[model samples]
Target: MPYAVDFDTVSTAGLESSPVAPALAGLRANEARYFRNKYAHVFAVEPAGDAPEAVDWVHHILDAERGIVISSPALEATTFQVENIRMAYVFYRSGLSINVMYTVDDGGKRAVGFKLSDGMDVPDELASFKFARQRSKLAGTIRGSYFVIKNEY
Candidate 1:
């Protein structure tokens, strides 16, 4: 059986009628952006699947588009038990893959952000994180949103 997790559901998964959701709702009240802060954050995240599966998705997406600032090559998963959180990469990167298992998160009033704390091990510097942020944001915009491997072209 397949589950249908749409943009609406996906964006509002952990958030609801709380002040947070309402605040987010208000931000987009009269604006037009593909995805607001609602689903744009993947703090120290697990990519909604197994570690290997997530890494594969990252590889396919980033490999096709090339990369941003990451010097390290290859994609790696920074796993988490929670869902819908976004993690970011913000520095020198290259061809490589490393998993940062633990990440520190600070959920702001609107946009959520995170920091890969000390002692935590990340496979790559963070180039992939940068890419993931952009990719996931676009992904969340697909109405009834979901990700599929585009290996067959």
Candidate 2:
């Protein structure tokens, strides 16, 4: 089942297995708020089991672009398109959230973003990247970093 993320009332409905469930829930809500505010799109996510395509897409990108592989299991995943941009998100049990933003137009911006929940340590595969902290009312302090996508997906 797809659960619509509510920024107004952050919940851990689909992320209970995570050690940093609260912070992860808040981080999920922050993404919901962004899409709602910017694109008038409701951000909904389903169990990773139910969204293999989205999960696989993210995995392929990680492997192809940076030779990176995440050790944590994904809890939920989502994929959607707004305007010309296609976006995918995977929420992992380690309190890590990864997003891929791909614009359909040639030479448009494309990147993979990594956001760590407030209470969790940065994953080993991502330690080399420096994360900048951002304060969010819903997610508390979020540490984030990203790399530009070099190849066409």
Clash count in backbone of candidate 2: 0
Candidate 2 lDDT for residue 16: 97
- Per-candidate TM vs. native? 0.21, 0.99
Could you give me the TM-score of model 1 versus the true structure? 0.21
> Model 2, 1-153: lDDT tens per residue?
887898998899989999999999999999999999999999999999999999999999999999999999999999999999999999999999999999999999999999999999988999899999999999999999999999999
* Decoy 2 TM-score against native: 0.99
lDDT (10s digit) by residue, model 1, range 1-153: 112223343342322432333322222221113223444422332222324554544444444543423343222233333233333221111212222222234432112122221222333434234322211331222111112222331
Minimum summed lDDT over a 10-residue window in model 1 is located at 138-147
Top lDDT model: 2
lDDT of each: 0.29, 0.97
Error of 1 at 118 (Å): 12
lDDT of 1 at 120: 25
In terms of TM-score, which candidate is strongest?
A: 2
